[model samples]
Structures are given as C-alpha cells and as structure tokens.
Target: MITSAVRQALRTRGDEPAVLCLIGDLGPDRAELAALRLRGNDRRVDLDAHGMGRPVTVEGIGGEGEPSSVGLVVIAADGLTDLRRAVTVTTQLPPTAHLLVVVRHVPAHLGPLVPAPPTIDEWNDLHELRVRRFGNRGWACELCFPGGMSVAEALAAVVHGPRGRRRGPGVGVLGGLSGTQAALWRPGDVAARGVTATGPVEIDRVTPVSDLVLRLDDGGGLPFWEDVEVPAVDRLATDATVAPEVRSPEARLRVYGTDPVSRVAPVDERFVNPIGFTKKTKGPLGELVEVEGRVVVRDETCVRIRPTPDGTVTENDLERVRHLRGVRVGWPEHGDTATVRIVAALAAGGVPLIGDPAPMWAAGLGAPLAELIAGGAEDVLLDPLRREEHSIRLRRAALRTHGVRTRWRSLAAEAGLPVPPETRVSVVLCTRRPELVGFALAQIARQRHVRFEAVLALHGFSADLPEVDAAVAEFRATGIPLVVHEAEGEKVFGAVMNDAVDRASGTVIAKWDDDDWYGPEHLADLMLARAYSGADVVGISQNFTYLEELDLTVWRGYRSEVPSPAIVGSTILADRVVIEDVGGFRPRPRAIDSQFLLAVTRAGCRVYRTHGFGYLLRRAGGGHTWNVDLGYFLRNHTEQWIGWRPSVLLEGVPAPFGAQADRHIDHPGEHVERL
Candidate 1:
C-alpha cells in the first residue's frame, strides 16, 4: 500500500526535483523499506523518522550552505499527535514542493489543519478494500477490491487485466421499492433468487422457470392471495398477517429494519433546525407555516418543522437531517409504509427525538421504541438539556435491534436458510490497583445485551488477596463467565494485556480499566457501532472524567459518533482476528494503547469512536500508566461540576466506592491544594 501510494504521489507531481524529504514516524524498518524502494527508482530520499521538526533542505544536490527547494515531500504520521505535527510541516515546505501526507490510520476528525481533504484507502472488517478521493466535488470512488482477493493480486489486476463485469444470477422485481427498502436485500442473495417479486406471485408458475421465487410483503393484508384457496407461494412478510394456508413455522413474519448508511453517517453537532419531519406528517400537531412556497410547521417551542415531500427518503435526505436534534414522526399505523420507513430512517440516523410509537407494538418493536417516543413534542422534544442524552440511548437501541443486516439475518433464519452465529465478546481487565477490583467487577457485571466473559489479569498482584477474592466471588455469582490470570512479577502493561487476551475465547475483545466507570450498555453500543460502520475496531472518546483528588467532574468537547484514529485506551474494543492480525499489543511498558492503534491503522484497518456518555474516566493523583496531570484535563474541559455528575446514561449505575462522600465537598476551591 505504501509503495503504491508513493508511486501515485510521484506521478501526480509531473516532474522530479532535487530532493524527496521523508518525514514523521514510520518506524525504522518501514522507513528503510520506503527508502530502498525509492532508491531503486534512482530518487534521492532524505529520511527524518522521529518527527523532530526538521526543515526540508536539498543537502546533497545543492551548494554547501545554499538552501535548495524540495521537489516531493511525504509525511508518515503514526498517531493523532504525530498527524498534527505532520500537518505543521506543510507550512515549512517551499512553494515548489508537492506535499503528500500518508498516515497508517486516518482519523475521522482531522480538525481544520489540512488545507484540503486527504484521499483515503480503507479496508473494512470484511476483506474488501476501497479507495476514495475527496475534492471540491466531494467523495469519488476510485476502485474497490472485493473480499477474499489479495491486495497484491487486486493491484496487479488493476494494472494489467481488462475491466470486465462478472456475470451472476438474475433477479426480477415486479413492484416499485424505495431505495431504502431495496438496500435491505443483499446483492448476492437477490441475484441468487431469480424472482424477488412482491406478494401474490403464483409459486408453481414462477418456480418452474426460476431457481428461487421470493414474495415480499409490506405488512399489508395479502389481498391479492385472498382468492387463492391454496396459496403455495414461499413468502416474506414484514408483519404477522400471512395467509393461513402458508403459515408454517418457516413462514413467520420478520420485522425489517433501517438502511445501513444512515447509521454510519457522522452526526452534525451544530443544530440548525430543532425539529424535522420527513416523508409523512399525519400526527404532528403543530402550527402550519409557508416558507419559500414550501410547507413548514412551528410547534410551541417556536422550532420550525422542515418537512420533506411525501416520498421515499433517499440517502441524501438522511444525510441532510443529520443536524436535526428531534425528528417528528407519526405512529406506524397498521400497513402504513410511509410512516414505518420514516421512523426507521430517523432512528438509524441517531436523531435524538422520535414520536407517537404507540402503534409499533404490532410491528414487533414495543419496548425499545416506546422508550424513545415523545409524549408531547413541545414538552419532551424541545428540552435542550436531554437531547444529547436521548441521542445516545436511541442510537444504541437502533444498533442492537433495528440494523438492516440483523433484520435480513432474522428473515434468512425463519426461511430455514443459513445464518451467521451470534457475536460473543471477551472483556479484558488489567490492573495493578488491587483496591479497585470490586469497583471494576461491579461495572462489568452490570453490562447487558451482549454475551461476554470477563478476563482479569492482575499485574504485580495476586488474586488470592481478601479484597480480590471477595470481588471474584461476587462477580461469579452473577452467572457470567470469569477467568483470572495472575502476573505476579510482570511489569510491562502491554505484555500483561496480551496474556489476558490469550486467555479470552470470544470473537471480540474489549479492554477495561479498573478505575473507570461504564454504563450497562457500553459493550452493546460498541458492537452496534462496529456493525453499521464496518470498522475493524470500535471504541469511545474520553469525554467524561472524574478527578478523584479534587472531587470534580470534567467533560471534554471531543467529537463523538465519527471515525477517529484513536480512542481512550480503556474503552477499546476490537475483533479478535484483527488483534492477532496486528501481532497483538506491543510488548512495551507505556503507550500500549496508542501503539496498538497505530499498528492496526498501519495494517489498513479502520478505528471508529462512538458516543462517550456511558464512560467516566477516573483520574486519581498520579499512579496510573497514563501519566497526564489533573490540571491538563481541567484546562481542556468544556464543562465542569462540583461533584460526580455523569450523563443520564449512567444514572442507574452505582457510584464508585467513596465517591458518594466526595459529593459533600460543597465548593471545589476547598480541594484546590490537592491538585
């Protein structure tokens, strides 16, 4: 990948120059390899692998003291901090040099540093690799390497082979389906089934000419098949209204879900419009207004309702409404397809508020949907304080229950087709602080909606201690699997983590810190983000922190719900396969998390950062591996409270031991000396 990227950069420059300045941290071996490749092409390469803020100068090609202008510059950043330093190098480069910045992992939030958008070549959790270029015209796809194909073979094919379309099975649709609805069907499955027509297709008539015939229904009554005395069609119904003759165990209704694109799109924090209603507007009781000849409505909060036309909500439509805090949706009445689609679109897009979900009980989504409904749009939806809180909850629920793949998998199972097994996670907790063992185990025990086992690795301590033994017994009583590994003399944090990972038998592995607090749905939310984003690793930002010394809580303004190069080390969750692919964590004493992320990104795997409302990082005096001081967090915090005030997602979670007493500190200034 690096060789190809360098070749492309050189080709784009149009001409060779005196010197090619190589900067940033690409490790010594990679730097040498890159230099060797360039030398074979007869290019003069100058390496600066440590990112020492060196000036790019043509030393060998120019006069002894005269500063020579550079021709091509390539920066290789290892992590987010290194990426920022690499961006600064562009300012120091001469006007003649054409700069190309290459990072092993590209973070979602690049900030306002880059002059233009950088092109990205990403490999998803599936083996497929896609190259995307961003310019004034937005993102354009260059190429896609299919799954199970080696990268070298794909590159060679792109260079020499003819670009011919591969043929597959044919599918014929009898009725019109919205783009959102059409996206639910996998391309391969649709091609395999010769006819995927809407309900009422005669089975005997179509099955003779086609390999497979699938009849799709929109939850409406099967009026077309009402006259047929013995309907022998293989059906796919969205609701519980199939014909009695065909109501076998394999013919049950499977509730379909929202489009996948909406779930992966970045959430826009700046809310220009407060309330939005798209495609359907039957039950949103509000004052009507006309703006630019378009229908608009204003509720009691004076928040205007931006309504889209009564049609299918496209991908572009979902992207546009990403900034809206609340989306007003009508009840999914029986057989009301428009309302159903609207609800799903809003839910998957992470819209904070949705409404009138009383009628969704018949649609197989009663409890989760009811939790997100707005009782009164003006009262509940307009509350600014709870909007972000609601968004976290709604998006988490959508990932666990309403993903398109999950819906399709359910349908495939009911039809007696093959389906993938459910995902199981292994939570790895490594700690030297034996005092915090019970606190950590309690948090792990509260997690829900995921099949997970906890692997506790005690560094420089024994699990036989009274406090550790008692916590282990309490945690085991919850019926969850637990494995304890004692590293009595091991000092390296990274090696200890690797030992814990080796003991884990789960498909997915999550790292947990002993001193932090996590909500019940933390692991479930990470799984959901991974499913929709197709990212190899998924974790949360360190948005919330509790300063144990000063008895204060700080909330940082880090951007969540996007793809970032790095996340908080404690909240990291990744597939076990990717972990092994990257050769596990580096066997170092410090910066283990950052180094592991760099390795993953260098291997062309994506790292995604989801919402951090459920996690609370505790910063005690100074014994932690991450040795940043309390004052640093205080300086970067967007908001602060006197005591431990976590987000609403952590409301039911019990406070850490002795945290309840810190709530009585009245004023934080009294504990200023402790910092």
Candidate 2:
C-alpha cells in the first residue's frame, strides 16, 4: 500500500521530479520501488528512503534537507513514529516541497492522530481504507478545505502551532481521521497569506484602500475606487499668510492745498510730508522734484518761523524763506530766528515795513538799476509774476549758473528688417548704425564651424549711409547671406523690431544694435548654451560705455559683455518663431521694449544666459537710450496696465535687469499655448 501510494503521488507530480520516500529503509527493494515508479510513470521519480532498520530513527529524517530537486516526500506511518524524526524531516523539506503520508489501519493510535474522520468518498483508491481524527483541531484539514478555506482563522492556527498537526492544545478538533488513512498535503503545500497596506491617508475626495477588487459582469475588475465627502478649502488662502510684511513703514498722508503759500499743518508722529509743490507744475525740474513752503511770522525786514521738529532744515526751505515777502537776506534763511533779530521786530523777518516786498524780492535785486526803485523801495511794488522773472535774473547773477539744455539725441540708428533662417545659427546681427555695420557683418562672414547670417535694420535713415552700403556689399562678396530692411513708418520701436523679425532665417537668432559689436566666438558659444539649457532664448551681456560723437567711431567701441547673470532681456539669442507667435512687439512709440518684454514673459518660454561676449551697444548720440516722448510711453503704459495686455516683444528671452533695462526689451515666455 505504501509503495502504491508513493507511486500514485509520483505519478500525480507529472515531471521527472525527485520523490524522496523517507521510510526507515534504504535497501535494494526501495531502489527497485523507485525504479518501478520511475518506469511505470512518464516522470522520473527517485525514492530516497530514510532508514533500512525495522524501526524508523530520528536521525533518518535529517536527509530531507530542503529537497532542491525533489518534488515530493512520502512519509509512511512507520517513518513518522518518532515525533522528532517527523519534525527533522518536515523541517528539511524546502518551503516549496510537498509531503504526503500513509499509515496502517491501527484504530487505537489513529483516533487521536487527525482532526477529522475520513469518509468513504474521501478515498479515491477503494482498496485503501479511509480514516480521520475527531474534534476541531483549531485548523481545517485538507479534506475540510477541498474548495479552499473560506476564512483565514482556521488555517492560521495550523500554520502557527508547535507541530504541523497540533493547532492548539485545548481547542476542539473540527474533524478526525478514522482507524485507516493518514492526512495528505506536503510541508511545502501550505502557503502564507500576504499582508498588504496602502500609503499615507489622503484627506481628499478620493481615499486609498487595498485588497478590494470589484468585478464587473464583463469580467473586468476595478482594483481601487473611492467616493467620499471632502470639505472645500479656500484656494487663495490655503498656502498664503493672512498677514504679510508691510512694505511701507509709514502711512501716506495726502493734504490737499491749492495756494502756493498755504500754511500746511505738520504730519502725525509716524509720517512726514516730504514735499510741497503745485499740482500741475510745469518744467521737468519742478514737475518732478521742486518744492515750496510758507512763512507765518514776518517783521519789517525779516521773518521769524517755528523750526521743524527734527531740528534740521533743507536748502529748499531756505529758498522758500528767501522768496517770502518782508524777509531780509540771511546766510541760512529757513532755520532759527537769529537773522530775524538782526533785521529787528519792526519788520517781521527783515525788510521795509511799509511795502509787501515779496514782489520786490522776485525782481532783480541789489546793485542792479530799476529806475522806479530810486525812491523809497516800499513805494515801488511789482507784480509777483514779473517779480519772479526779476528774482530769476538776480539768482542767476548771485549763483552764477546756466539754464538746462533741452535738445538731446541719446540714441540714433538705422532701422531695418531681420532675416530669419531655418538652421542652427552661429550669429544674429541687428543694427542701423553705419559705423558698426562693417565690423558686425565682417564677423558673420568670417565665422567658422557654425553657419552665420545677418539682419541689418536701418532706423531713422534720412539718406542711405555710404559706410553701411559698402559694408553690405562687402558681406555679399564673402558669400555670407545678409537680410537688409527698414522699419515701417509710424510704428513704435517695439513694432519696428517686430517688422524686422519677419526676415530672420536662422533657428538661433541673436540680437544686435547698429552701434553694437560682437566677438568672433560669440555665436558658437550662444548656440551651445541654448542646447545645454534646452531654453528657447538665451541672453549674453554686452558692456555699455559712452562712444565718440561720430556714429561710426562711436559705434565701434561699445561692447555689451554680460555680467554675473547669464540671462538678460535687451540682448538675447532665440528662435525667430517665438517672436512671431507673441504678436511681435507693441506699437508703443516710447519705452517700446518695456511693454513687449512683459508680453513675452507671460507666454511661458524658457530664458537662459550664456557665458560669452555678446554685443556692444554704443552709449553715444544714440537717441534710443531715453524715451524722448513721454506721452507715447504713458499711452503704452496705460494700455498694458488697463487691458493687462502683453507687449508684442520678442519672446523666450530673460530681462535680467528687469525695470532697469533701457534700450532693449525682450520677454521669456512663462507658459506657451499650443495652437
């Protein structure tokens, strides 16, 4: 029966699997049984019996050491007699190895052996009687789990107990083995249930759960799906601090007064009125920085006034005192009353007591002759406006100063089109200055290893510049392609640049000015920087310096060598397409680049900087530096501010200096929208 069972088990294990029949004998019969099992079945089965004596020894079980090649182990009733021997053998069976045992029909020993009594139907072989133990053994036997255990409780006990058979000492056995057969599964047949867990608990609309697989009628399964109520939080306030740092330490106090000589009250403790001036003040100097003050006490020849709480006064206050009526001349006119005492109490601050001399002070003073002034000064009164003109004349004589100059041509250049290409570019030259045209075009024609191109835009050209015309012809002779064009009339600078951009033909387009020059390797290094950064635009710094008066000589010496930051605005390297998509530059006549730059940044393009010589922007008579027309700039500023519109500036470039950038304007796209 043992031989039949071993053979049956070997046959069940289809392959040429090693079958270790760990019985108490290893004699020739055991070898023959192994060979017979091997021959009778399609699989090769080797029977390695543990002992050859009448009784199975504990030491015999030691041979079962992790059956590496063995598929199963057959433990006969005789071989399992020694508890220690059973353990040793079972322990040696590798985690994956299976065990099957058979026992004789010994009624007394079999009753307590198994948890269940085997029924007649449980035995497939009718010749072999079926037997089972009684009571719940706190674990389900193989027979109780024919369709697999519905719950983990019963199996847990058997897998956790001291011996493979004893689940709990006092637990009631669910079933028992009768006086004939033994239990079936091998040591390796038992599997461990995996414990799985989800990650951190997320308090959101959907929470995570594990092990629950929902099956649809179509045989598909949803491993995880969650539905839960989630309270909404304020998005703006979520990560924001309720109280931010106050940028201005003092409150701004606006005290309105129309009169030029109005006595303004002092400001509160934490604040100070730093200035006093007319609302619609004219003239550049006063419109921005001019100030005025009032005098409350005046004597016949001087003025006595309370000093500011700070105990200090500025030159402007002294000038105000000097301009006051009935006030006599004092070395320092705004602070203290010592000068007033010298002029006496008869006159408030020191002047002729009879006449309102404020008007007289405004007129030419001292040794200058005014025919009517030969009589008593009080009798000769002048209108304030006329007095102001005279005061200006006197001040001019007293201070020995000249008036400010009005006309200025900060930056001037020729405007033209930009020729864009489709290949990796070695250089991009933008210019209008006739002097610089030669140097920039020559560099492009002479560049090696990388392809080169030029975009010469002539702005404000009255007549064709002879020098620039010659340079263009020279560049053409060298076989280097050049695109020369002029700016569209009646558009802002931003618009002018946008028009020039239509002609760029290179993948990596660089910026150039009519007065700017470049190093030989500038284009090569800029292209490399573009590749490494994976950016749409890269900027190089150009050193700024004042040039000579001549456009040509002035243009040649200016250099824009970038500083610490590699990225910048005015001078950038990028693809031409980026410029076209951003609607080009705005038509703002003043501060044209400023508006366009803002637009490019909003578009979401990467801006980087390259470490190399970029270009030289001449800081000479180049009228481009200062936006001479304020009205045009304000118009553009208002357009951007009100509509929140972006300027059609070049995109994909960084404006490193930001608000401080003067002549050039570019924008790095922040977010790009796919068309």
lDDT of 1 by residue, 461-523 (tens): 887777778778878888999999999565688898999999999989999988787888899
In model 1, the clashing pairs are: 107-565, 108-563
Clashes of each: 2, 101
Q: What is the lDDT of candidate 2?
A: 0.32
Off-target runs (Cα >4 Å) in candidate 2 are 1-422, 426-432, 462-465, 542-570, 590-594, 612-617, 626-675
Worst 10 residues of 2 by lDDT: 403-412
Best-matching candidate per TM-score: 1
For 495-546, candidate 2 gives per-residue lDDT tens digits of: 5666667676665566655444344445654554343233456675322222
Measured against the true structure, the TM-scores of the candidates, in listed sequence, are: 0.59, 0.28
